[model samples]
Target: MEEKFLKVTQEGHFFDKHKSVLIAVSGGKDSMNLLHLLYKYQDILDIRIGVAHVNHQQRRESAEEEVYIKEWSERRSIPFHVSYFEGTFSEEAARTMRYDFFAEVMKQHDYTALVTAHHADDQAETIFMRLIRGSRLAHLSGMRVVQPFASGELIRPLLPFPKSELMNVPHFEDESNYSSLYFRNRIRNDYLPLLVNENPQFTSALLHVGKESELLHQALRDLICHIDVTNLQDFQAQTVAVRYFLLQHYLEEFPELQLTRDQFDQVLNILEKRANYQHHLKGDYYLIKDYQRFAITKIQPKTDRQEEEYVIESEGVFQHGSFIFSLNEPLEQPDQIIYLQVHQPILLRGRKAGDRILLHSIHKKIRRYFIDQKIPQKLRDTAIVIEQEGKIYGIANMVASDLSKSAKNDIIKATLYIKMKE
Candidate 1:
């Protein structure tokens, strides 16, 4: 078992022998074995070790596991950090929250890498799951041995070891793992056993296939990078041309690298359509077209949705979705009867065709006058115009009339303030 651990860690280049490591302990057999093995080898490796556990409030037994881990850490005099979350076990969400906690802990401490007990069986199960889900080669490649985590990095030193090898170390069993309701357990206890019975070397074959596929996948991705997708003036229109170029190049250089007809069609659809154009590729892979530079992004996903529109009204202070429109009562002036008064309610709606506006100064059709003024069609609707009983009193961004019916001693002026949403 020790020899196997050394071989895996050395081959995977998971961590430096003397680096400070934090092991994620779930009190399960896998994580327990991981902690024990690291401890057993710590002296020779000259490394510092810590244990981190997440108490997901799923079952009552989960609390017991946390207690066991905490006691074990104390016994070894190893620093321990436990995080608790109140939620059902949604695999994705739980994983995210757990990693976030792990990152925070790492930031507070000085850990070089966060190690976990994801072994060969876990990788095999993942590969099969992704395969059944019709995943691309990248997903089928399964979890990487070394990858970046929250603040530090994540290292899976046991990936090359089979579950049977870890049985030598003391461990605890979670009853939930036996339930076929969990997809991974079903693959481990049921499907994999049947495959092994049929062909004793099936697991080895799968591992081999995973490795070969990873290499081929990397090569294909490299070829994809060689094609210059930048400067495609119209992404939608040029999608077919870009795809055809890729197909031609692939056929000439790597005929074995053909995607399924459906997959090819889907790729083209993703490239051409605006809706899902921003969708990410597998495992730090992305397709990006930023003006003149088209590239693949390796970072985690970030969302930027379009901002929705808000409406504004007069007389009353209006709070739109993200914008605040405050309309103040006109300043009082004895002679200025044309100024906006607080008495009337203002209507706010989008513009429609043939909507006429009476310019107080000229009494002309506002739309034609706006067109003559060279106002763009897009901005015309947004340009606010105030009216009283179908008579245009003032046009915002254009003109404000001195609507005092009598020679004024004091005049009233309506003030409108637009504030953006927070």
Candidate 2:
């Protein structure tokens, strides 16, 4: 068992020579065994070791467990760090808090790797549970032997070894493991034992499933390695399976976001819808789909608001929202080039209630005009118009009023330039 632990760490390249590592120990048999093994071979491995523990305060033995681990570390002259949870937390929240504290410790001490004692049984339990709950193909592979965490690596050297092999060392056991209150506890205590009894090789089979799923993920990753997900045209060109996998891969890049199968389908639905849309996800992040493009952005869509007016006194160049106005420049579209005869200090501004434009000696409300043109709500909010003496000249770059197009001398040729948001 000792030789296998060393071999796993060495073959996996879990540590560099003389690297510092922080081991996450819960004083449970599995973690204590891991700590003992690493301590025995620290000289041969050429590494420094530190111990980190978190007291969830869920069990009555929590305080005793914390002290036990601290004393064990002190006896070996190894550094020990600890944290305490203030109140109750769900299983997921507890797990998050535990890792967060581990990351904090690593940052302060410059530890290169965070070691955990998640053995083969734990891996099997995780994969089986995810399979039962229905998860993405990439997520079915269970915990990785080594993965990036915080600013360093999170290493699980005991992943390929079973729990039975790790119980040789004497250590504390949390009584909560036998309780059925937690979903994982129920799975481990009730369902898993029956499955193992029915087929003694069930755990091994689950382990094999994880390995196969990982291979499939690797193959899918290779297929789309060159594809750009943000490019709508490029993304839509792929088959559905390829697209789904790409999105899952994209979501994985963000540590703050947790990807569920439902969220996956929500994103797909928005992408498939014909019209441009902005679907709000958690916080201020949104999945934005514009004509010819789509992106993951934090910038909120331009909503209707009372916008400030900018007077175009003698515009060489003027910026308003996402638009740039270049005054006195020859425009590509003849109608959009407003040939102003009566210059009464033209102003550029967003839409207002009861705003109207003159068209062939008839008044047309700007709101009704936008509706007739089939402008999207976001575009309408940022849409600008040229106004002078309370008379609308034109909707920038879209249409020019007949009055603005009238033949005249001393005309100022003004055009609008749309600037793409960064």
Candidate 3:
């Protein structure tokens, strides 16, 4: 088993010499095996190891497992980090919380890699679950052996080995693994055993399926790697399959936005149909189509003061909503600029109901102008307008009405810069 471990690590290029890796130990059989093996081989691998554990606090043995793992790490003189969940969470939520804690530990402690003990059995189960749940091909392939995660790489050195091959080690077994409260537990305890009894090599067959699916998935990913999804013309030029994969790859960056097949198809359809379409996704996020480009943006929540006017009597620099106004000096990459001959105090504010701006001797409603210009509603809501003496002067970054750009020499020169969204 030790020789096989060395071979797997070597072939996978799991770690570089002299790099520090953080081990995710849960006091389970798999994680314990991984912790001990890495400790035993650290000298040969030329890597340092630290331990991290997250107590989900679901099972009765949770506290005992946390203590056991911490003591084990202390005995080996390895750095240890532990976090306890505040309350009971669903399985999905718990998994997310667990990884979030792991990521925090990695970032704070400067660990170069996060090593886990996911073996072939875990991979097989994951593939089976995803398949039954109707997932995309990429998701159905199960977990990757190594992927960029947190501050470094998330590596699973035991992926090639079956669970039966792991040597027996003293470890705590959480009873939750046998409970039906979790979908994975039900799959592992009930359905999987039945299938294995019927066909002894069923798990191996699923592993084979996972490997083939992953190979195809990687091929699709590589095919769309050169296509930029944000560039409308370039993205439209790709084949349909490539385009789908490109969108999938783009959404993968935002793990919080989960879309079903119908919703994903709707996005693709919106791209093909027209511009200026805003589709609300989960939370405050929206998929917006500008004239020629599209992007996912989170609309800022509205506040009571979002529409409040700022009285700028004489400004050196003033911030109103998302725009920064600089008086008499040029700013790098100003979104909009206009010269104003100030005879009265000017007001900087967002658009209000019944707002109209004078452009080329014609009055146009601010709302109509925005719609005609194909500006997204989210941007229009926060669009800053310059006003003086009960008349609208300009909508910053979109238009500077003829009234705002006066020819007078006694000028209050102003430049508008929009702040980058957080």
* lDDT of each candidate versus the true structure: 0.64, 0.78, 0.80
Candidate 2 off by > 4 Å: 259-263, 300-422
Counted clashes in each candidate structure: 10, 0, 0
lDDT of 2 by residue, 1-422 (tens): 88878887777767763389999999998899989988988887888999999999888899999998999899999999999876668888889899999999999999988999999999999998998888766777999988888878898889989988875677887888888989889889899999999999999999999999999989878988777665567778888877877888777766677656687689987776667787778777777776445666565344556368888777465667665666665434333466554345778888654456777766566677888889887778777878766667887766677767663333444443333333
lDDT of 3 by residue, 7-100 (tens): 8798777897328899999899999999989999998898999998998877788888888888888998999999887765887777888899
Instruction: Give the CA lDDT, 0 to 100, for residue 228 in model 3.
Output: 52
Considering summed lDDT, which 10 consecutive residues are worst modelled in model 3?
A: 413-422
Residue ranges of candidate 1 with Cα displaced over 4 Å: 221-422
Query: What global local distance difference test value does model 1 have?
Result: 0.64
- Please name the candidate that would achieve the greatest TM-score relative to the true structure: 2
What TM-score should be assigned to candidate 2?
A: 0.70
Candidate 3 has an lDDT of: 0.80
In order of appearance, the predictions have TM-scores of: 0.57, 0.70, 0.69
Error of 1 at 217 (Å): 2.1
